[model samples]
Target chain A: MTGVAALPGTATLAEIGEQAVIATLTAGLPPAADVLVGPGDDGAVLEVAGPLVTSLDVLVENVHFKLGWSDPADIGRKAVAVNVADLEAMGARATAVVLGFSAPPHLQLRFVRELTAGLHAECAAAGVSLVGGDVTRSRDLTLSVTVLGGLEGRPPVLRSGARPGDVVALRGRTGWAAAGLAVLSRGFRSPRAVVEAQRVPQVPYGEGAAAAQAGATAMVDVSDGLLADLGHVASASGVVVDLRRDAFEVPEPLQAVSAATGADPYDLLLTGGEDHALAATFAAGAVPEGWRVVGEVRAVGPDAGAGVLVDGRTWPAAAGFDHFGAAR
Target chain B: MTGVAALPGTATLAEIGEQAVIATLTAGLPPAADVLVGPGDDGAVLEVAGPLVTSLDVLVENVHFKLGWSDPADIGRKAVAVNVADLEAMGARATAVVLGFSAPPHLQLRFVRELTAGLHAECAAAGVSLVGGDVTRSRDLTLSVTVLGGLEGRPPVLRSGARPGDVVALRGRTGWAAAGLAVLSRGFRSPRAVVEAQRVPQVPYGEGAAAAQAGATAMVDVSDGLLADLGHVASASGVVVDLRRDAFEVPEPLQAVSAATGADPYDLLLTGGEDHALAATFAAGAVPEGWRVVGEVRAVGPDAGAGVLVDGRTWPAAAGFDHFGAAR
Candidate 1:
């Protein structure tokens, strides 16, 4: 090895080129079998049986999570969790994941290892494995996760399949994660529930496939607030969704946290995000186990044109998060 | 939309969270068939027939390419090309690609658009589609591409399959990309051959599968220098490879650039990278149509551990580019 002076662990990524940095990051990791090709190739291939569902998500440091607040492992878990939620939304089970990580050169190798370990833990929880990934040195920390899922011969539940008179239901908590964010952003001391929720989201993981098997017409994961995500189904399916706030009430834990944080319970219920809850429209009848009816889907009307209404009023907040928003 | 003061087409990515940035990037792109679910879910699902192959690579700004030297389109093409070449190395046909992009807030939207366009163009060239992707705000530019491929019933060629008496052959030009980098580093004006080669690499796309069908024992892509990549085959297959320098001649266009740049042509031929060419070892006999025999794989000897030799001398250059090298 050349006797180049090694910089401290805080060196900026700009000092190194991307390729050279990646080579260092992946120097001696064990390889997996499904990964026919690993990091150095143009793409990776895994041997698998059945139909594949794929999803991709990107995470930037500070923007996605403050390093001061979250450890590297937390960041890794969150990244994997969110992407796995996408597969759940498609009514599929995650089988494998591929990661793309970009960080500055000064970042510690231990941090990356811990982060990868976190990813592996989450993958194990989801009954999948990390097949392949890439690492490059960048100006800051950024992670992109792509997950593949398998639908064991079941038809995929799409957002565009809700029909008039369908009963809308949710299978998991809808606003706890957003409430947790609100608490954290306000600089409150660590509370077990809020802190745990913030670090790693709890998605009702297997409920998506359960919902699909139970004859759910359309489904989505509540990632960007309930009203906002429902609006996507409404617009796609050309239907109006009317949600009953009382029926889809905020649970006791979330209400207590909202009260403590001086946050609007209604805002958390209607407009909060990162819940990873499974929300679906089912044919009117008995809802599946672990699911509760929360609303109804109707034909589009002048007052509600492919939109969502909470307790007879249009949601006041902007429809979820947009990347190029003025705040950026 | 909130009437926040807009920075004049010069927004930095740091200001936006990774998720919001990705939302903006994927706002209006149409997805193809294999993309059962697009960017928003936990993961995107892609349709596949038979066994699947996946590969990933990450490119950080400044490290992979100088942003000042390369426009967004060039960066995009390189990212896709490198990942696609990995799939080709497996003798599989690329089917879809998912991208993860992170950049600071000050990045131009036009740059992102151009980058996307370039990705699409490369995908088109490879007869694959840009199925889905994620974009987010970051402190620096980071691109991570994951590619999936389909192998229609053929067994994948592996690095550990070469044996004694196997003939080592090459299917495409080697070292042109490394030569191009030399030209660029010297601040030379764009020459047709050097500039074009740098922008997009030309890998023998379908030859990996062709070589496999022709009963090749082992295969790898020449993304790192030919000698370094071949070393992987040597070590994995427990064989020693002896390359005949007389047989490893430089192509005409590359020779012209080497002469003009005052660089040693031999260095380009042996130690250069980013060519994405296919190098494989076949059982000695007739090679495939587009392949040329360059050496022979010999049994490992007590004195010589599994490695590569050039023209009867052990190659002294360090094996291929490592991301964390002192030069980086």
Candidate 2:
């Protein structure tokens, strides 16, 4: 793109148009070493090696996050964070991300700048770069991020590899984001940490490779709640997972949120999703440090069905978020 | 996801929901060897070697297309095609794509299935696979496609490499799609070929590597108008590109389209975009077979400024599309 003159003041995208906005968005961004060709080309070229791990996720305004509830920066960070969590789940180091941002024409240039800044900040935290992306006009805000990662030659830990007798472990906190969502939905002034977690939850990024180094068999991000996501493992591995709720040292902030919202904290921990924690199965005595064994995998007996169970019984909780279901 | 029983008859997404719709999408799709882990996982693992190439593009409803004006399958194919064009422009062998398709809850499942089928058809034509993706509900239909390609040990042809004395060559037809768009915009029942061209314009996919092999200095897809996109080449290369309008063999269909719509055929040939044609700069007489010489790159003389000019004069025509501009 020709270096269009920057508009004088805070103008809407419609007033300044796309070319100027793109020029401004890309201005002064640090260049990446691995990116052979950066933005302004038809596409970006990267110096990638080893197995390529990729994931795509789309977050829509109002549906994914209400503009009134979170900062533009928080929304951008969350979009990158959730996609990065997927790459980390597979024991991959994220190298790059490509974003597709769609917004209304009347959207302010300031909002776009803030969103881009947030994306840059989150990518820096993960040691990745925004190599390329596209932007367009839409009726509402839309963010679609595709993350590319490298396995560094390690075999990816697949969900089907979890064997019976493996220990089910969890990394990172749970229920905080969901509880934060609960507080926000009710317009309550909840604990700051809990509320912040809901806005931009942190994933245990490095623990995936650590778990893999420690011989973890299978892994997934706890995006769809502990029970629900683990259920995917059980189905794929043909094993039953039994969780011990008492093993989890539920944080006091979550408990306070439960008290404030009058919602069961344990219930939120069990079923509320968007925590973006790393959950994996490791051989007994092989669970890595900074991880806690929360459950165990067992062969599905004829009398027992293969699914996630709590205390050797079916868990009585909501079944996590479903995009097209009544709950979400 | 539980194997929810299918709702009989053609059901809307709201009726069958996301799980069932995803099931329908992934079912009966052929497997690819490069894909170690496919859909249903947090991310897809691709067995990619060599330098990686990636590009992202988003097509929003009413902004990029209208449902009433095009078939859902055509829209899907167009999305995949446009992303594939980016890979082709970089002289990379297109390998795989991940899609993020968001639509309103009331969208029909049939429409989604048709769209996916079109994507599969187009990807198959390019010898690539739909490795994985995500779907969500939205206010308007949005398709964000990320294409992955391999450089296969070849150095990429960058836009900055075009030097004075290079010949500007183009492969594949130009202006057909833009002419087709004109016909559609005017609500005219133009030639079927022109209308189809507007919907699913084909690119000379294999010609990118061919151009690179023939010592092409720089290359890009003509997504924007020839002069405008070539202006990018000029700005990047620090040279002026002068087009010979007489050199282009404007296709008969475009001529027919122009006659029917009362549009200037030459203007359409020069400024119409979305042709997915490959334009490149090569040393004189190095233009590959099946490619036509359209222009020449020259140094910025004291009397002539750098940028795209037509037949030694500046052309008077609209420069391609701007997503956030009023015309679009």
Candidate 3:
């Protein structure tokens, strides 16, 4: 890393070489009690307990993100947030993460260092150890991250555990990122609040454990919109979910963006994605503080009824963020 | 899954969409006892104990493999083999694997299915579970795999543990993949052994624990050729490694390919990479069956000496496997 740290300001990744780039990225990454062996080895070793919860996510250039609109740090932070959000949904404590990054060799050395800084920052905020990673070259800038969680002997709250009488609750903001995206898409960058949310999600960190302790029956991460994600719960639980549209008060930023973009506030709140809020179901009396009831679970009708309904009526829209979009 | 299965065999990935493609890939995947909850949830839950050893590897379209040179299945197998080899080097039992796959939407549906089938086949061979994965779109076909391993309460073999009197041993073939690569580079694909080795490394299964039980001091995966990988061990352990030229007898396939290609077999053995053999350091008397001694470790003294040498002389070639190649 001495070689990379001493290079000129305009140095590219190709100029410093892969070893130097990797060394620079991993240098001074703080060690954690959970990580027995960190980066620079064939593998990382972590102290573990009970069950392991793990998930994978990939962010591709021009697909999941655009370099023109966001800084590399923002993208790095969002990567950790998205994966940690999944672990939170499963009622597991975020433990550690390993990343695989690939980009064209023409990428700048400073951007690589900044990305790792962002990763370290987010992992620390999430109470996770940045245990290990790999770097390589690709035609597009891409990140593949895997988050590992530990249950600490508690049962994982799955989407299939919702009962007919459970109350649906949400712990964090929804559709704010979507609003931010709408604003950015319209070529406007003001309203810094929503735009910042789009760059880095304000995930409700410890609320997952709190919800689990409060005897929540099921949980989900609101990544694919409130309706779309809750639909997974309804389908998996074999129940009907009915949301109160009045419960969702569109934020001022969203309203402003909606007004300017000619987009529907309700549509953004119900169907926009990447907000990364935690959604869960609990007994009516068991809904804890900080979690507000937005809907109720009901038994499925004989016709198998509907999955997720708004105000007990079908809401017609594309389910959520379909990766293929109109290509399908 | 039914949507994906019912589509025309000639259909591209864009036609079936991400969800359907995911379903098709994960459909009917055999559940392992270690995987308490397999795919479809926010993450896979695995039953675990002791420390967790994990590693990540990324393979890009042209950087790691070429579509014209190999089948999608071979690429898939190689991806799993490469990551699992890292675990084997650490004296850990390979437990589970999670994949992040991305490719252009116009890619054929059959290739995705075949790739997954290959992943499953390799995981089974390695006694690892294909527990979870994510699907996305990128300009280049890419696979990022994270392998999870368990130490089962055994001390991990680290690269820094080799001592001056330790004997260097190897448990799998060296330079076969390189020989295969050389044959393929010349547009000659005969001599199926070496060619297949390039396409799918036959990683020695379960050798990590075998070496560990026999009191191996240090270990490394030979993904970066014998001499280069041993260099890591030498530098980490502050020792000088000297390999016997006569100790390494080139295999028939590699010899044949080397002769036809007019490439130096010694260079292939010393610098050509991606064979994925497990190299370990053990006391001279502790080298176990199925393991063959290749070199000996000597204490670093005086001018601090060279890291790795062949027959007590400096090896003049560049180490191995720079992803940026001449672009650097």
The candidate scoring highest on TM-score is: 3
- In order, candidate lDDTs are 0.75, 0.85, 0.86
**Candidate order (DockQ):** 3, 2, 1
User: Model 2 - which docking category?
Assistant: medium
- Pairs clashing within candidate 3: none
Question: Which portions of model 2 show Cα errors greater than 4 Å?
Answer: A1-9, A326-328, B1-9, B326-328
On residues B179-263, what C-alpha lDDT tens digit does candidate 3 reach at each position? 8888888898878888888898889989988888889999999987888889889888989888888898888887897889887
How does residue A322 of candidate 2 score in lDDT?
68
lDDT for model 2: 0.85
Q: Provide the lowest-lDDT 10-residue window in model 3 chain A.
A: A319-328
What DockQ, on C-alphas, does every prediction get? 0.40, 0.71, 0.74
Per-residue lDDT tens digits of candidate 1, residues B1-328? 1221232335444454444445444544566776666665444567788778888888887777777678788788888888888877777888888887766667765666677677767777777767667766565677888888887788777788899899999998787888778878878745667666776788677787788788888888887799988988888788899998889777786788788877678778887888888998998885799798999988888767798988757977746775544352
Q: After superposition, how far is residue A293 of candidate 1 from its true place, in Å?
A: 2.3
| Model 2 per-residue lDDT tens digits across residues B144-209 | 999998877788877788999999999877788888888888887577787887888798887888
RMSD of 1: 4.8
Candidate 1 vs 2: which has more TM-score: 2
Kindly report the root-mean-square deviation of model 3 from the true structure over all alpha carbons: 1.5
lDDT of 3 at B264: 79
Once fitted onto the true fold, the runs of candidate 1 whose alpha carbons sit more than 4 angstroms away are A1-47, B1-45, B256-262, B326-328
